[model samples]
Target: MNGIKNAVFTDKSIRLLGKNQYTFNVESGSTRTEIKQWVELFFGVKVIAMNSHRLPIKVKGRRVRSIKGHKKHYKRMIITLQPGYSIPPLRKKRKELELKNTK
Candidate 1:
């Protein structure tokens, strides 16, 4: 769904996968209930719990000018699913497949 931007696969998030949890970058305006419903409907997994936090804002400016800009803000969500349920790998597997095809 539009609310969910993409799956996160940093070292920490990869480790969380072993514990039946998945991490994702979601729209800042998306609520927990909305995300939970979308995940369940899209992935067919039961979400047991969810934790979310907004990533720190990053500001950029030029030394020569007084103008500054802020990067788009987003929220990160860690979702724990019911045992025996899991989301399939997203990017890594697709990239692997593409490489194999190119070879």
Candidate 2:
């Protein structure tokens, strides 16, 4: 897969942060080992475990005769890091979001 695309920060993911887990949206072709290496190298965190899931394709605008189109499917990874390790980008985004919310 192409490099780590982006991180997911939904309500569910936010709750997982308390347990030292992070969610990232990755290319469909990426492997678990690749994700582990990338996270360790980029975030300076020790990845203990990783789980990947493929989201189902979303179909829209169905016609009477046939289907219209479908949104592309994507892979997501949930990474569990060793205690005391945290990703700076994730923290920065969270802080920015909090500031936005407060204002």
Candidate 3:
């Protein structure tokens, strides 16, 4: 569980959802096996395949030009689940709330 940071939702990721693939931000040091195990145990879904890659580190600095640091690096994991299984969409609740407020 600690290895997984959070679910990732983006234009590309949302499209992958239709294919039963889920994306997540994981700790940079986490391996595919570790992430697969954690996701399966926590979500109770069967993971068929896992693909992971590290995202590029971003540089950050203060306006003073003297202080600079690199943002925390993380890995992105794409997990494909067995047919007929799925994790709930994270944006569903937010969309519902937004619709309610707009009405």
Clash counts for the predictions, in order: 0, 0, 0
Ranking of all predicted structures according to TM-score, beginning with the best and ending with the worst: 2, 1, 3
TM-score of each: 0.74, 0.77, 0.73
Looking at model 1, residue 52 earns an lDDT score of 94
| Tens-digit lDDT track of model 3 for 1-103 | 7898888867678768778888889998887888888988998899999888766553453233222464456878899999988887654644554567679
Q: How many Å off is the CA of 69 in candidate 2? A: 11
Highest TM-score, which number? 2
Clashing pairs in 1: none
Off by over 4 Å in 3: 58-72, 89-103
Tens-digit per-residue lDDT, 28-51, candidate 2:
777888889888887778999999
Winner by lDDT = 1
Total colliding residue pairs, candidate 1: 0
Clashes of 2: 0
- Cα lDDT of model 1 overall? 0.80
